[model samples]
Target: MTSPVPPADPHRLPVTFRPTRTRAVLIGIGVALVVVLTVMSLLLESFTTGDRVTFITTGLLGLGVLALLSRPKVVATEDGVTVTNLTTVRRLAWAQIVRVNLRSGDSWVHLDLSDGTSLPAMGIQTGIDRQRAIADARALRALVDAHGTVHSAD
Candidate 1:
């Protein structure tokens, strides 16, 4: 008889990046706006189907933007890194990354690609806590150092 395969360990999965306070604020604001608008709409005695539709549509659009804020994140695995932004999610291997830059005046940590292009890691922003952002950037740099390919200074 064939031996049974063992289940993989759950703790060994890729470590997810820390959540941001800015994202929480965004979600809070969006939810608050939606609630206030919904309450107001219901209070209006002259509310019609068209008005309801408009209110719902506006709420959805606003909430969608807030949802995007919650969606962005950076995950670091042994294989590579995953960056999810507002409009896109990119998976990049260690070899594809050139550098990680987190500096003053920048809104977020940006990844320099080996292809001479750059991508912003919106998951790490400098809005809420500057110290925390710096720390996260350092941690990400450590990940890059551990798994990324090294290039010679030509």
Candidate 2:
């Protein structure tokens, strides 16, 4: 059985939701990979200067990609929500969000907008930790309910 989600305090103007485990894993792996590659490049006596530089550069590029993968987060304030995905950052007013959904089998939470479009909220991902993702989704839903304005269809 699922427990009731506690009401979010309106006084808390800003709240951030992010995937902790995923971010930690990505960063840990990325850093370790970079360090290993760098050390190997330095130790390899057969590799020329150009080869060593290329190896280090490759490692840095891999780290950059991992960093991007771990960049998703959602910041909610009294005024609006700011969602940062892999490459895009979008700010949306409460009214702009018609609904927040995290259906079964969904990888992440999706926000239904008043414009009839859905925005993926990667910060509340279910892949790494399902329970935490569900909680975060519920919290986001509560925030939307409290702050979002209803738009009547014409």
Candidate 3:
């Protein structure tokens, strides 16, 4: 049997769930890459102006991609939940979310919607930190239970 879910923290409303370590690491790498490229472009005597610009531009592009990778987040509020993935953002009401799941071997939390669709909540990924992901998923599930309408079995 699974452990009981802890109560949702009411004071933590407007809470944001994200991969903390992954985001920090990605952002740190991005910043370091940009700085290194910029310094190289300025210090290299053999590089032409065009070459320097190209190097800086390439670094910036790489940073942009890393930024995108670190952008996933799930925000929960009294109104509803807002899921922001790599390239998409979706908002759903409490009633619209039927369940929140983070099963074993799953990479991230998946929200089962009343519309019969499942949305990948990349913000709570298990790969980087499994315990934290499970806690976050349980918290989200508690929130859904507290706020969402209860459906009767047919």
Candidate 4:
């Protein structure tokens, strides 16, 4: 058995969203395939029908692999925040983000926008420092306070 390891100090903020239902389903199917593989091994099979199972397991595993590879990366600079998704990147001015807080479960950064809208910043992950995360959020709040106006993103 191995022990758990804590996350190292992250120099760059990379936000991740809650795994989508589609992704979770893929993982669940992969796990189920493991069970099926066990059953097939015990049965008297000739050519092995396990090929179908193997292909399914591989496909599901591929989904998980794609999810990880396709996750977005978020970077904060003095001027603005950048959200880099798989196909495109969008930059939001600091003024557009009224506040940024690690969500209750520390899953993602929740952005309270100037338009009374909230957005999940899927590019950053929640880390151990809850207090630090809150403090970081406050700093973002200050930035918006200085420059943000209603309908800024509009």
Candidate 5:
């Protein structure tokens, strides 16, 4: 059973973009790996101090990777777009945006800035689900067109 999606605000742009499958798979794998590692570490009967440290560090690393995978997103609102990539989160006003690009060969949607800096919209990933990615990119372009004075690349 699926719950109905809430209606979007007419005056505001859509909320956010997300990768369909890749993120779920990655998050599942990350959580599973961390759990397995932790269980094995705890079950071990003997452990040196160094071994304990290494085991804990490995689990923490898995959690860190999970955080990274789950964090990236492109959020749009009446004010602007917020892009959260692997290591950075940037908020840009509509006027600062130059274009949104999701070319056929590109891995993800890219936001072109007026400053000439291009930022990847990791939330709208391609290759994993091509059609969905295309549709999302188009929707994002529509938002940009409606709220901002910018042209997107083909």
Candidate 6:
């Protein structure tokens, strides 16, 4: 019998790494909202009937999921950083980024470009997303430091 070859080494560099936030917390929150709605229905039954509870619960869950998942996109490439919005994408050459404060506020990576505009990193606003995103941020910072010579940060 022929032996199978193992998969190529997973640590290969020059690959595009995407930062992602987990949906567990959001899902949990959705569940909690449903429970809260159910409880509220029992207490505030003057307006909502028994049938409305089901509809309200389902609607709330859907809205929660949608809101939680609707986030911005941040990408790093050999050239520079890219921030994406709901309908548009912004690309900043490493040179344009003056300072990147990977700390505080609205749960996002804060960016300060040379022109005096500040924006947050796209993903990992909460939960596991924070941990993973911080790690990736470190890596991206390192990569930028080593390669982005023309681009400086303070």
Clashes per candidate, residues 3 or more apart or on different chains: 0, 0, 0, 5, 0, 1
How do the residues 18-126 of candidate 3 rate in per-residue lDDT, one tens digit apiece?
8888999999999999999999999999999999999999899999999999999999999999999999999999899888888888999998889999899999897
Whole-model lDDT, model 6: 0.57
Question: Taking the tens digit of each residue's C-alpha lDDT, what string does model 6 give over 23-92?
Answer: 4455566667777766666776575575666757675867566555654566666678787644556887
Q: Which window of ten consecutive residues has the lowest lDDT sum in model 2?
A: 1-10
Task: List TM-scores for all candidates, in order.
Answer: 0.82, 0.90, 0.89, 0.43, 0.82, 0.53
Those runs of model 6 whose alpha carbons end farther than 4 Å from true positions after fitting are: 1-19, 23-68, 85-88, 104-106, 124-126, 150-154
- Leading candidate by TM-score: 2
By summed lDDT, which 10 consecutive residues of candidate 4 come out lowest? Answer: 1-10
Write model 1 residue lDDT over 82-133, tens digit each, in one string: 9998889899998888888887798888899999998999877777776676
Candidates' C-alpha lDDT: 0.75, 0.86, 0.86, 0.53, 0.79, 0.57
Structure candidate 5, residue pairs in collision: none
Off by over 4 Å in 3: 1-12, 150-154
Model 5 quality (TM-score):
0.82
Where does the lowest 10-residue lDDT sum fall in candidate 1?
A: 1-10
Task: Report the Cα RMSD per candidate.
Answer: 9.6, 3.7, 4.1, 8.1, 3.6, 8.4
| Candidate 5 lDDT tens digits, 1-36 | 233233334356557888747788778878787788
Cand. 3 Cα-lDDT:
0.86
